[model samples]
Each structure stands twice: as C-alpha cells, then as structure tokens.
Target: MKILYLSLRFPYPPFSGDKIRTYNILKHLSYKHSISFVSFMLSPDEKNQINKLQEFCKEVEIVEFSKLKAYSNCIIRSYSGEPFQISYWYSPEMQKKVDNLMEKDGFDLVHVQFFRMAQYIKKYTDRRKILDSGDSFWLNLSRRSKLDRGIVWPLLKLEASKVRIYETEIAKWFDQVTMVSPLDMQCLLSNDSNLPISVVPMGVDLDYFQPGSKSDDLNLLFTGTIRYFPNKDAILYFYNEIFPLIKESVPNVKFYVVGNSPPKNIQNLASNGDIVVTGRVEDVRPYFDNSAVFVCPLRSGSGMQAKILEAMAMGVPVVTTSMGVTAFDAFIDKDIMVADDPKLFANKVIQLLKDRELRQNIALNARHLVEEKYGWSSIVDRFDKIYENALANRS
Candidate 1:
C-alpha cells in the first residue's frame, strides 16, 4: 500500500512517548507497506534525523515550524473559536505540501498522526484518512481546565471548550479515527457519538527493556518529559504529597525524577538530597533496571502511560494512580499496584520496597503482560489492519 503518514512532529530520536509510538508503528508498517511521511520539524537538528527515518520510510518530507510563527498564529486564532493548539500548528506551507503530494501521486491511504494536524486534511474527506487521534485532545484539555487556577484557568477553560467544538466537527472528515487507549476512545465516542473510533495501543520494545538479573536498593523512579503539564504535576504531587509520607518510614529511600526539561520546582526538589532530577539521559532502561519501583502519580492526563509499560517490560514492579493506568487492561494486584491516594500510594511503594518476593512476582507478571499485549510488533499489526480496513471501505 502507498501510505501517506502525516505527523504533528518529526518521529525521530523516539525519546518521548508520542514520537516513540509513531516511529515504532511506522517502522513495523514499513516492512509490509510503502510509507511517505510529511511532518513538522521543531528544530534544525530534527531535519538531520530525517536521514535516519529514511531507513524505514520510502520518502520523508519535514517542514520546520518556527516557534515565533506558531505562537503568532495561536494569538491570531485565540480571538476566534479555534483552539490555540490547533492554530499553533496551522501552516499554509504544510497544506500546500500535502496538496502537491496528493495531486502528484495518489495514495492508497492517509494516516494523520495527531489532532493538531487534523485541520490540514479535514477538507480532503474524499480520500481515505485514518486519523490517529493519539489521545482525546478535548478530554485532556477539559481535565487540564479543572487543574489550572485563576487567570490561566479561564484561558484553559476557553481553550478546552474550543477543542471540544473542533473535535466533534473535524472527526466527521475522517474515514476512521484511532486513539492509544480504550478509555480515550470512550471519551471521544461520548463527545462525538457518530465518529468511527478504534484503539491502537502504544507499543514498547521488550527486548531492550527485559528484566534484569539483580535488584538494587529501594529506589523509586518516575520518568517522562517534565516540561509537559501532566508530568510536571505528577512529580510535584510525588514530592509534595507522597514522598514526605514515604520518608517517615523509609528514611534511606531515594526518589529519582528522570526526564528532559524539568521545571525549576523539580530542580529545587533535587537539591534536598533524597530527590534527584536527571534531566534527559541518553537511555532510560538502565535507570529502570536499577530502581526498586517505578511510580506514576499522574493526576491529569489522557491515554496510556508509556513509561509504565516501559518499566513493566523491564520487569520492574510499578505502583501508579488510576489515571496512570488509564487505557491499559492489566490486573491491579497481579501486574501492578494501583493507588489514587498519596498515603496509599506511599504505602504500596514502601510495601514493594521491603517485600522482594512480592516485587519479583509483580515484575514478572508485568513483563508477561507487556510481551503479550504491548509489544511493538503486535500493536503495529493492529494499525496495519486498520489502514487496510480504511482503504477497503474507501474503495
């Protein structure tokens, strides 16, 4: 199949969840299908990475999006009904590129990566489009509104409303739409009942993340791009609400907040000794292997937590909130420890820290779950089927 894959960002380096998910799926699909990619490059460095992607994609086209231009567009559209996020990515150059490609070579299917890029293809409803929503953007925005406060709160609330309006209307333009988790799909269906939605889970590389032979001391780790609101909030929640409680019992225990672009608050937490914030490492598997527990205390976010899956695939025991476990179908006691409250979360982490047998059992179960369900090969196969279905329906 001649597939046109449209991405909101360049899926290179595969460091973060969004990029990793898109890159792995495209890598797998490239084996059985020919893919031509058109995506926005955030930096000049990303342009050089396009050569690396050429190994998988038959053709790759990346358009650099200037921060100044995107922000200006957002301000211009903020006055109107459109979501700032959608407007931020709006570029005539991208539309022109897509138009030029479609006019020159006919594609069997067009796979739009995220909601931000959905605007470019909404008018091209005549062609088969498989919209990968990634997550329900409206739902995420609405959740954010409740968490944000004061003046920023009203802005978030307004943006959330705009996102819902856009989502409901733009969804009608795609042949089919998919999200990372069943929970996200349900949220989308509830908001827009008529849209055809499916679940294509985020995948992990099990080989690189498999269980280690030895276990380290009771060290708790939380990994993500700390610049993101949900991740920053999660770490803040851990440091402020949960870690203090855990410290009373496990005085020697260490907490590592590992990721890129950590805020000053997170950096300050690192100064207090027990908490260490390693901003962006070349690899995260070693940290996962060395840690006694992986905790994701996410209060607000949509879709699956890829870090949880990565840790699970590494055979590391995990303790997370109900929000952290969002779209995954794994059993709580069998695969992980699920806790919504800070005290209970701290208790669970402490329990796993002391009980080696329990930790090993949960880690083994979690690894089994990922290998069977969340492995890259299996997840991408589902995407291939969805693409085939979209093309078949179009014909």
Candidate 2:
C-alpha cells in the first residue's frame, strides 16, 4: 500500500507516548507499505533527526512549528468555536504541503497521527483516511478543567467544551479513527454514541527495556515528561499524600522522578534527598533496574500510561491508580497493584516493598503479560487489519 502519514510532531527518539507509537507504527508498516512521512518539528534539532525516519519513510517532509503563531491563533480564534488544540496546529505551510501531496501523489491511504493534524486532510475524500488520534483530547481537557484552578481554569473549561464538539464532528471525516484505549473511546462515545472509533493500545520496546537485577533498598519510581500537567499532578499527589505513609512504614524509602522538563514545583522536590529528580537522563533503564516499585499515581489523564507499560516490560512491580492500567487486561493484584486512595495506594506500595516474594510474583506476571501482548511487533499487526477494514468500508 502507498500510505501518506502525517504527524503533529516528528516521531524520532520516541521520548513521549505519542512519538513512540507513531515511530514504531511507521517502522513496522514500512516493511510492507510505501510510506511518505510529513510532520511538524518543534525545534531545529528535531529536523536533524529526520534522517532516522528516512530509513523507513520513502519521502520525509518536516515543517518547523511556530509556538508564537500557535499561541496567537488560540487568542485570535478564542471565540471562533474552534478548539485551541486544533487551532494551535493550524499552519498554511502544512496545509499547502498536504494539499500538494494529495493532488499529485495518488496515495493509497492517508494516515493522520493526531486529530490536530486532521484539518489538513479534511477536503481529500477520494481515498481511505485513518485518524490515529491516540487518545481523547476532549477527555483530557475536561479532567483538567476540574482539577486545575486559577486563571487558566476558565480557559480550560471553555476549551474542553469546544474540544468536545470539535472532536466528535472531526472524527466522522475519517474512514477509521483509533485511540490508545477503550476508556478514551468510551469518552468520545459519550459525546456522540454513533461515532466510529476503536482502540489500539500503546506498546513498549521489550528488548531495550529488559529486566535487570534490582537493588534491595525501598525505592519508588515514576517516569514521564514532568512538564505535562497530569504527570506533575501525579508526582505531587504521591509526595504530599502517599509518600508520608510509605515513609512511616519504611523509614529509608526513596522516590525517583525521572524525565525531562520538570516544572519548578517538581524540581523543588529534590531539595530533600529522599526525592531525587533527575531531569532528562539519556537512558531510563538503569533507574528501572534499581527500582523496587514503579508507581503511577495519575488521578487524571486519558489513555494508557506508557511508563507503566515500560516498567511492566522491564519486570518492575507496579503500584498504580485505576487510570494507569485502563489500557491493559492485567489482573488487579497479580499483574499490577492498584489503589486510588492515598492510604490504600501507599499500602499497596509498601506491600510490594516489604514482601520480596510478592514483588517478584507481580513483576514476573507483569513481564509475562507484556511479553504476550505489549510488544511493538505484535501491536503494529493490528494496524494492517484496521487499514483493511477501513478500505473495505469505503463509500
């Protein structure tokens, strides 16, 4: 198949969940399909990484994204009834490039990586179009409106309303629309019960994140892009409400915040030695190797937590909230430990830490679960089926 793949961000290095999903899908599909990749790059350094993607994509095109222009669009179109999520990514250059490609390329299928990029292909209806939205932006913004306060609260609330309407309507344009999990699919369904959408889970690189010997010390780990609101909220919630209870049980317990672009509040956590905030490590495998328990205390977020998948893939016992494991079919206490209450979450962590046998058992079960289902090779095969079904349904 000749596929035209469009993404909101360049999916190289695969630092974030969206990037990881897009990169692996393109890499795997490249073996059987002819893919032409076009995406927006946030920085010049990201442009240098195009060579990596060129290995898979027959043709690669990147446009440098302007945050200044994106913000201006949000402000100018604040009352245009367009969601800021979609407006922020609107670019004349990108539209022109996509239009040119669609007019001349005669591609078999058009695969859009995110809903933000959905606008570029709305007019081209001659071929099958797949929107890999990854997750519900409407659900994410709705959660944020309730959890977040301050001047931004009103904006979040308004944006959530706008996104709810836009997301429901825009998805209908695509032949097939997919999200990262059933939870997100349900969120969109709640808005429009007849909307056509399905789930395609996020997977981990098992080989790169192989299990390693763990240290005996009580160390809890959470890994994500800390600048993201959900991650920042999760870590802070754990530190303020749950970490105290865990420390009372295990006096020498330590917490590690591993990721890049941590906010001021998250960075301040490192002031006390117990919480070690390592911003932007080249590799996170060593931290996973030493971790006794991987905790994801996410109170709000749509879709699967990729870090949890990575931890499970690396044989680390996981204690996370219900939101963290929404994408997986793992058992509550066997494959992972789950708790929403502060005390209950702390107890789950302490239980895994104190009982060596329990930790090993959960870790082994979790690893087996990932090996059987969460590997990228197995996950990408689903795309071929989705593509076939999309093409079959053409009007």
Candidate 3:
C-alpha cells in the first residue's frame, strides 16, 4: 500500500508523546507499505531529521512554520469561528504540497495525523482519508477551559467551543477517524452520532524501558515538555502543593524534572536543593530506571500520557491523577496509584516511597501490562489494519 501520511509535526527524535506515536507506527508500517510523509517542520532541527525519516519513508516533505508566522496566522483567524490551534498550524505551503502530492501520486489513502492537518484534507470526499486524532481535541480544550480561569478564561472557552464544532464537522468528512483511547472515541461519538471511529493506543518501547531490578536513590520524577501548558501547570501544582506535603513525611525524597525547553519558572525550581531540573538529556530511560516513583500531577489535559506508559514499562510504580490514567484501565492498587487531591497524591507517593515491597509489586504488574497490551509491535499491528482498511475502501 502507498500511504500518504500527513502530520502536524515531523515525527522524528520521538521525544514527545505525539511524535513517538506517529514515528513508531510509521517505522512499523514502512516495513510493508510504501509510506511517504508531508508534515510541518517547527524548527530547522526538524528539517534535518527529515533525512532520518527518509531511511524509513519513501519520501519526506516538510513545510517550515515559524513561531511568529503561526502567531500571526492565529491572530488573523481569531475573529473567525475556527479554533486558534487549527489556525496556528494553517499554512498555504502545506496545502499546496498536499494538493500537488494527491494530484500526482494518487495515494492509496491519506493518513491525517491531527486535527490541525484535517483542515487541509477534510474537503476531499473523493479520497479515502483516515483522521488520526491523537485525542479528542474538543475534550482537551474543554478541560483546559475549566482548569484555566481569569482573563484568559473567555479566550479558552471560545477556542474550546470552536474546537468542538470543528471536530464534529471534520468527522463528517473523513471515512474513518482514530483516537488513542476509548474515552476519546466516546466523546467524539457523543458529538457526532454517525461518525466512524477506531482506537489505536499509544505504544511504548518495551525493549528500551524494561524492568530494572535495582532501584536507585529515593528520587521521584516528572518529565515532559515543561513549557507545555498542562505540564507546566502539573509540575507547578506538584511543587507548590504536593511536594511540600510529601517532604514532611519523606524528607529524603528528591524530585527530578526531566525533558527539554522548560519554562523559566520551572527552571527556577531547580534552585531548591531537593528539586533538580535537568532540561533535556541524551536519554530518559536512565532517569526512569533510577526513580523510585514516577509522578504525574496533570490537572488539565487529555490523551494517554507517554510518560506514564514509559514509566510503567520501566517497572517503576506510578502515582498519578485520575486524568493521567484515563487511557489505561489499570487497577489502582495493582498497576498504579491514582490520586486527585494534593494530599492524597502526596500520600500515595509517600506510601510508594516507604514501602519497597508494594512498589516492587506494582512495578511488576505495570511492566507486565505494557508488555502484553501497549508494546510497540502489538499496537502498530492495529494501525496496520486501519491503514489497510482505509486503502481497501479507497475509490
């Protein structure tokens, strides 16, 4: 099958959640299908990564999108009903490239990566298109609006409303749509009753994140692009509200903030002795292996957090919010510890830190779960099916 893949970002160096998901699927699908990619490159570094993708993809084309241009586009579209996110990513170059590619190559199927790219191909009812929404974008924005209040509240609410409307409208255009979790699929179905949706879960590299028998120092870790709103909010919430409470109970506990491009506020958190912010690293698995517990205090966000899945795969017990565990229906006492309140979250972390036996038990269960259900090989097979089905249905 010749699959023309459309992505919002260049899925290379698979550091973030979306990149990892898209890149892994492509890596597997490329083995059997003639995969090509047309994606938006946010930085020059991503353009360089195009060569890396070319090793797997038959061809790779990227349209550069600068921060200033994206902001300008957002401002231009703000007055209109379109979601700011979709507008931010809108590019004439991308549209031109995609249009030319479709006309020339006659792709077996168009695999749209996110809601942002859906705008480009939504009008093409003549082609078989699969909309791979990493999550329910509408629900993500709605949750953001509820959590973020004050002067920006109205803006977030407006964006959420627009996202919901756009999501429903785009569903009608695509032959099939896919999301990371059943919860997101349900959200989509609730809004558009007749739209076809499928679940292709986020996969973890089990080989890289295998169970570590030896535990390191009593260090708790939270890792992601801290500049991202939800991650910034989550770390801040943990530092200000939860960490102090946990420290009272477990003074020896150390918190490590890993990942690249952390905000200044998060960087400043490193000034404290117990909190160490390592802004990006060559590898993250070592940190996951060394950590006693992986904490995800995400208050507002949707989708399966790759951080959680990575930690679980490394056989590290996770103490996270209910929002963090939405994708995986793992037992609270067995696979992970789910806590919503600050105190409860801290208590869970403290418990895991103090009880080695309990930690080992949960870590074993979590690793086993990922090996069985969330491994890259198994998860990518489901995606292969979706691609094959989309191609089969192509006109």
The whole-model lDDT of each prediction reads: 0.87, 0.90, 0.88
Backbone atom clashes (below 3 Å) for every candidate: 0, 0, 0
lDDT tens digits, residues 233-296, model 3?
9999999999999999989889999999998999898888889999989899888878999999
Candidate 2 lDDT, 1-395, residue by residue in tens = 99999998898888888888889899999999999999998989987898999999999999889999999988887777898888799999999899888888988899998889999999877779999988888889888777889789988898888888888898989998898899899888998888879888999888888888888878899999999999999999999999999999999999999998999999998998899999999899999998999999998878888899999988899998888888888999999999999999999999888899999999999999999998988888888999988878783
Candidate 1 lDDT over residue span 70-136, tens digit each: 8899888767778898888999999999989888888888899888888887887688998888888
Ranking by TM-score: 2, 1, 3
Please state the error at residue 74 of candidate 2 in Å: 1.7
User: Which of 2 and 3 is ahead in lDDT?
Assistant: 2
Q: What value does the lDDT take at residue 355 in candidate 1?
A: 89
What are the runs in model 1 whose C-alpha is more than 4 Å off?
Answer: none
TM-score attained by model 3: 0.96
CA RMSD of each candidate after superposition = 1.2, 1.1, 1.5
Runs in model 2 lying further than 4 Å from the true structure: none
Give the C-alpha lDDT of model 1.
0.87
